[model samples]
Target: MIEVRAPEPGDLETIGREAREEWVRDRFRTGVDFSPLMDKPNTHVALIDGQPVAAGGFIDRGNGNAIAWSVLGRVDERHFVGLVRAFRKYMKATPYRWIEAHCIATFHQSHRWVKCLGFVPVNGERCFTPDGREFRKYVFRNHNGS
Candidate 1:
């Protein structure tokens, strides 16, 4: 069974260390600890049979806007889809007027997954990370929010 709950200490680090993407592992190996973020509101960890698989949350950006983020480890298709469903419910109940997520342009799965969560790509929008990697912006507008 899959469980989605508030992240506990070390959840992010555990997920980061086991991230399926090499870039994500490299980021974690740089000594940056994301465990602290678990204390933030909306942050959550996904576990399967007691093993951490993913962690993420929305960071309120004020003015009815927020940023969505997630880090994944090795996850089976079933749990991944379950996480998507949970995220959709969270978005539906959120008070944010807009929630944005940035996807690494080369990560095709991410692009598709964001769409699965109902985020629309911003036309003509392009963003660059501090390391110079290109990214695309996607936004989810909440018609029910202010």
Candidate 2:
């Protein structure tokens, strides 16, 4: 069973140990650290049978907008759908009216997953990270929320 809860200090390290090489390299090159996120409000970890599979949350950009970020560990294919459902549930529970996320333009699976979580691609808003990888912007907007 996958249980989503507040992140523990070691969760990031645990995930890093089994994360994909490309992801680890990108993080290192971009200086994308998850340590500070552990201190952020609403951050969470998804644990399957007491083992963390993922951790992520929102970083407030103010004015009802926030940046969404997450890190993944070695995940079982069977648990993919469940994890997506958990992510959607957590996203909806947040107070932010606009949530923004970015994914590598070449990673098709990532694009699909974010869309499944209710994010839509931002037209013509491509960005490049420090590593020179092209990324596409995605946003989740709650028009009915304040």
Q: Point to the candidate with the largest TM-score.
A: 1
The count of residue-pair clashes in candidate 1 stands at 0
Candidate 2 lDDT by residue in tens digits, 42-136 = 79999989999888899998898988988777888999889999998888888889999999888776788789788999998779989899999
For each candidate in turn, give its C-alpha RMSD to the true structure in angstroms: 1.6, 2.5
Question: Which parts of model 1 are misplaced by more than 4 Å?
Answer: 144-146
TM-score of candidate 1 relative to the true fold? 0.90
lDDT of 1 at 9: 74
- What digit string (tens of lDDT, one per residue) describes model 1 on residues 45-138? 8788999888778888999999888887888887777878876776777778899999989988789878988999997977998999999999
Pick by lDDT: which candidate is best? 2
State the C-alpha lDDT per candidate. 0.83, 0.84
TM-scores of the models, in the given order?
Answer: 0.90, 0.87
lDDT of 1 at 69: 86
Task: List the lowest-lDDT window of 10 residues for candidate 2.
Answer: 23-32
Cα misplacement distance, residue 132 of candidate 1 (Å) = 1.6
